[model samples]
Target: MTPTATGIAPTTNSTPTTHAGPAIEITGRLGERYDEILTPDAVAFLTELHHRFSGRRHDRLADRMRRRFEIGNGRDPRFRDDTAAVRANPDWKVAGAGPGLEDRRVEITGPTDPKMTINALNSGARVWLADQEDATSPTWKNVVEGQLSLFDAIRGQLSFTSPEGKEYRVTAERTPTIVMRPRGWHLVEKHIRFIDRTGRGMAASGSLVDFGLYFFHNAQQLIANGSGPYFYIAKLESSEEAKLWDDIFTFSEEYLGIAHGTIRATVLIETLPAAFEMEEILYELRDHCAGLNAGRWDYIFSIIKNYRGRGARFVLPDRSDVTMTVPFMRAYTELLVKTCHKRGAFAIGGMSAFIPNRRDPEVTQRAFEKVAADKKREAGDGFDGTWVAHPDLIPVAQAEFDAVLGENPNQVSRQRDDVEVTPAQLLDVHIGLPITAAGVHGNVSVAIRYIEAWLRGLGAVALDNLMEDAATAEISRSQVWQWIHQDRETEDGTPITVAYIEELIAQVLGEVDRRDGDRFDDAAEVFREVALREEFPTFLTIVAYSRFLVDTE
Candidate 1:
């Protein structure tokens, strides 16, 4: 029998509540609404999650560094032979589709701000990726308030009033199911501290804090609403990481007494190594797995980070030129679909980050055509669904899938057995336009603009009709670093040395200052430090968040 919402509320465990529970300390400012979400049971659930799995997360992280160091020392990664047995088994399949995930034909992704939360729930997409990782700046206010808003959202009690007297509410006849994306394994939520065994106050795992609190508060509410605890796991690099998450789901479900397999996850194949281990990753999370998503921007960033000094062969051109149609990207996406369908899982497409600009007809038309073409290709290639950044592009993607699906829910049965891919094809970056002056300048401009917005606690920004996020900033800086590492020259025959790129940065910064009159020195310093570094930082947001983004830490 299904549990009632009240049945899922905080249980009176004899384990003791306050000082004996988690020893968690909230250093950030808490609003009146925070109490609703940060109850004793929620904090205990997060504490339990941290105590149980953070060690494994740490081990996987160390494994990441070891593997990356080997790569840096000229050891190229290949598909793991140990996991061949898991992949070679043709009789195995992932668990049957969970509730509210039967047909994810279209998913919209955004932060969980008050206004954006209302907008996302109202967006006509089939799923709303309530993102806290990339689409959000992890300010303390943003973090706690985002959780508060999500709590209200799950119970259908969400509403918002803008400072300008504008009111927004969820009014959709069939609102999109919410699939939350927490921070990656590398991040730590410093605002939430707990006492360790040695009596040191340590920051809690960001993943545990986000996922645990949400599941504790809303798991029963969602099951009552006919959905389960759905998640989009971001930036995982290996199957062992997937196994850790699967273990986490099992533990959380059992601890809360929710049914097993009620938690479903869609792994984001964002990193280069993860693309090579898709089948193994799915196999690890088969019981709790939903599908795999193509996270294109991060994939590009990963290639650049993994093979930074590998030469001109790995040097990519402009971010714009490296589209889905590019050879390496095509290989990755095709392999993803084939692998997921072969395992009887949904193969979701990447995000079309174009947001319509209503003021200009020409710009809007161009974006429409580009989005239409992208979605059409995905639909034709047998992707069950695709993602869009804006509600305006929903119909554009929906039309393509509708034409292909007709009355069908998904194309999971269409196993692409004929498709075969090799490691060289997935790593082929040799085919793309040569770097151009425009490309160099665009990277500098976009990085500065996005970082400045991020510093001001906004993650998603519309610049020239494209919705840029943290991934955009990462790709921009990483691409520049890659070009510098190779000493590559632009189409104009100018070598992309640090000095030349610094000149372009100065030019762009001057232009931005003239238009906005707000100094961009902080943003410029960040861009320079990341792009001009001898070795790339895994994620720029890590440094930025610690040094510049904290509000009350």
Candidate 2:
């Protein structure tokens, strides 16, 4: 069969080789074992599997492994029903620039603090990550299910008005743009059947791989019924995992008579392993992806528990401070923007747990201030948007997002015709450059990237251009990126350049001079002023050098 124009090759054998069209095919020796790709043992195992099980049966095993172990391939239940409807809705127009679907509206699941989603919508929030995952409490989780049933029951007469003396009621359809949070890695089955769609059976139970397969099967079941998400897929670790789901989606779409590319998917970069594979996973599922969100809490835990060696401890923290300040995390978020933007995807940041006006009024205010600061900071850092749980905080959150939404980054990607250099990439690789006395001349690379993000409105920021943004309150990100960049390599192994780099620093710092003039003074800063002055700068220096000679090369 002729596959899609890009040659839809199934990453797993369970996927149909006979696609809508054949774009890619593997013609090598057929193997049923993982080791076959390299060692003789692998090959021998595949040989045994080939003889032991039918081709279709063996493909199922590989398919399952790819889903569970791979991390980011799991699906979120909230989106299960609306992808196609939104796509088919007469109002569902495609976005001109963002990745996946263009109508980047927020989905206000009945339980997702409706006030928050509504306000964010008013304030230009792109999409809300409403869920069972990180945002909602357990009580809300149970209530959300009931809400779903209410909305689903009156599918037709959805609008109702509660009169002052009387009351208003109508069909309670879920909000269109909110992304649902799954129960977690442990409860994907429950999420898939009832939460994702209406079902009450063990048919939905399975492991990570099995859940992914169910997504395909379920999507196929609902495609004609006008149900099922395109999804905010989660818990994945490898590009192979992404490819596997892509295969399943492809196979299922064909069976269900849905157009192959209509099903959109997003990955939750919730852990360190998932973080590293961000680019690759996006690349692999470029056709089917909606976008990627940085899962802050999970990612923080993952960094500590799983990716401790990868410059994590410093950016995150040992204490409850849990700041996403590590050079690597900063780079990760910036790259989240860069990777998604490069491919025209939406770069969404993780959630802010700063629920406001709590029992601790002071804590709530600080939390509010922190959220407001974070919004502007992350926006400047390259993100298109971010998330929050409380309605009061949404206004500040929306304000921050809006500040930089259309602000073209004065990023230093410009080059002469036939030019092949970029500031960020240059700073990532080419570390042999001579050093200045402040430190190795090579250390300047760090300052360069940090300055770039700042100059480009991504670094050193404040709200209303005041002490509002965290970047301005701390160190500039482009500086860290520049240092990391010059020390790092381009994806193609080409060395990055330093010319645009220094310009980035000078230009951004120049902006700092123009707006706040380094009066980035803060009695109550995101990080304590004393700590920022004493340890952060020096720590950044060490991180910069680590990039210069680290095994990243």
> Pick by lDDT: which candidate is best?
1
After superposing candidate 2 on the true structure, give the runs of residues whose Cα lies further than 4 Å from its correct spot: 1-125, 134-176, 181-228, 307-318, 358-364, 406-553
User: In candidate 1, which residue ranges exceed 4 Å CA deviation?
Assistant: 1-22, 513-519
RMSD of 2: 19.5
Model 1: how far is 91 from its true place, Å?
1.5
lDDT of 2 by residue, 305-359 (tens): 3312234212221122335664445655665666555555666676554555556
lDDT of 1 at 272: 89
Best by TM-score: 1
lDDT of 1 at 94: 87
- Candidate 2 overall lDDT versus native: 0.40
Q: After superposition, how far is residue 309 of candidate 1 from its true place, in Å?
A: 1.3
Worst 10 residues of 2 by lDDT: 194-203
Error of 1 at 396 (Å): 0.4
